[model samples]
Target: MTGDNERPAYERGTGFLLARLGSLTARSWTAFLTEHRLTQAQYTVLVALQQHGPVGQRRLAELVAMDARNIVPVLDSLAAGCLIERRPDDTDRRRRTITLTGGGNALLAAVADAAAVEQDQFLHALNATERARLNHLLRRLYDSHIPEAPQPG
Candidate 1:
């Protein structure tokens, strides 16, 4: 085992770096999303809908790393703006499925472009390949450390 004092500050301080990165990333995304009149949570939900097709509210919440209650207001805003529609699941009247509308898809496209620029600006020192690798590593860390809710079919 390596002694705590044997590593440089940067090497020994991954937790600090991770926390800062998370905070900075959220701030960056929020700034980018604000231009689209979206919160980071709405952008996240839009992305999830684009990727997953229609999904239950809980499933969508999990996709966006939010609690079910927290996702409701975002969904309501989207619904009111005609960006998304919520309907009862065919199999269960009590379960609602969330889907992106055509408007949502168009909005997401615009937001995605902004997201790319924001990501590039945030990680300007990293090349495309390095960015990909960093995403892979972060996903691996998340998979190992955070237990996800089982996705519904």
Candidate 2:
């Protein structure tokens, strides 16, 4: 393929749209999270815990797309607030599993409600059907790109 002014297929289609949408969605979500005294990183961790329950620190870091080293300070602050607890893993003495405390559960519930409002605010320009369509398309786009892990036999 030889062209001076031609662009790749994705540059003009789904990829470009997804990049723009992701930036807009993240910005809106971060602002909402800040109002609740949570950073985007903290909110991501909380959401993962709420969805996955107790998990090892390494696994949590992977789920939230954060470096393992950066997770410690956030965990420390949450632990100090009684929002999360760290306990020794039964099978691995050197590892600790983090779980949300009752307070953390309550706070996440409230934050989730606020997040719903924030989502509505972000999508206010679109009609209900358009919003639903956009969400469906976005999910499909992500699902197509994310590589699937092989299952152990």
Candidate 3:
């Protein structure tokens, strides 16, 4: 029980605050990606490929923190757009190595500027130092919970 000056129980929860922030950011990201004819999953895969180089489908899925089962449709959509290539592995014919296409690289470069702008707008309240601290804290939390997950560069 609390006075009228006190925040509600839900407002005091870190999870609730994080979820609210996540929803708002996700909507902005989704809208931005939709304009580029891409989804979050597709963007994530492209970034992973850019960072890690050509990798097999299962490894790509793992790198993106996505289930192997769910990655197929995302890859299919990217393949349809010719944004990515899936080639048979040299050593293992059964394994398909996924690579970001030249087109994907171009698209990522084009959108990188816009993404930075949007991110700046979203965190306009924070100064550069504060933003860095926030990111560091978030990364620590992520590493603690998902130790196996690769840290995004």
Candidate 4:
């Protein structure tokens, strides 16, 4: 535990490195989202709704990997902001489906573009090819680790 040139064990760990990277990016992203009146959870919900179209609350929770009960608050906030609306499912009168409002789509489009720019700035140390390769590898690993439902195109 006493070497002038040796790095610590945590510093050498992949998980630790990922966590450090997440922390660095999260701070900036959180602030940026706050300026747009969004939290990460709320933004995720809006993005999922945009991608999947209208879905029931339970299904939306599954898509976002969040507990159905826990997502209620996020949904409520979005509804309060008029970013989304819950409507009675046509097929099933018992359940409500969530749909993104036009305002939500507009906000998502603007924020998504800016977010991409922010992400590029964060990964500026990596060249374009390197960034692409890294993203591919990360997506591969994530896909293998998380059993994902096929998303609709």
Kindly give the number of clashing pairs for every candidate: 0, 0, 0, 0
Candidate 3 per-residue lDDT, tens place, 1-153, comes to: 456459888877899989999999989999999999988899999999999999999999989889999999999999999999999999999999999999999999988989999999999989999999999999899889976755546
How far in Å is the alpha carbon of 62 misplaced in model 1? 5.1
Q: Model 2 TM-score?
A: 0.76
In terms of lDDT, model 3 sits at 0.92
- Runs of candidate 3 exceeding 4 Å displacement: 1-15, 150-153
lDDT of 2: 0.85
Global Cα RMSD, each model = 5.1, 6.6, 4.4, 4.1
lDDT of 1 at 46: 87
**Per-residue lDDT tens digits of candidate 4, residues 1-153?**
456349788787899988998798789989999989999999999999999899999999988989999999999999999999999999998888999999999999999899899888888889999999999999998999988776646
In model 2, which residue pairs have backbone atoms overlapping below 3 Å? Answer: none
lDDT of 1 by residue, 53-145 (tens): 999998888888898998899999999989999999999999999999999999988877877777778788888899899999999999999
Superposition TM-score, candidate 4 onto the true structure:
0.82
Query: Could you tell me how far off, in angstroms, the CA of residue 22 lies in candidate 1 after the best superposition?
Result: 2.3
Q: Pick the winner on TM-score between candidates 2 and 4.
A: 4
Clashing pairs in 4: none
Poorly placed runs, candidate 1 (over 4 Å): 1-12, 58-69, 88-96
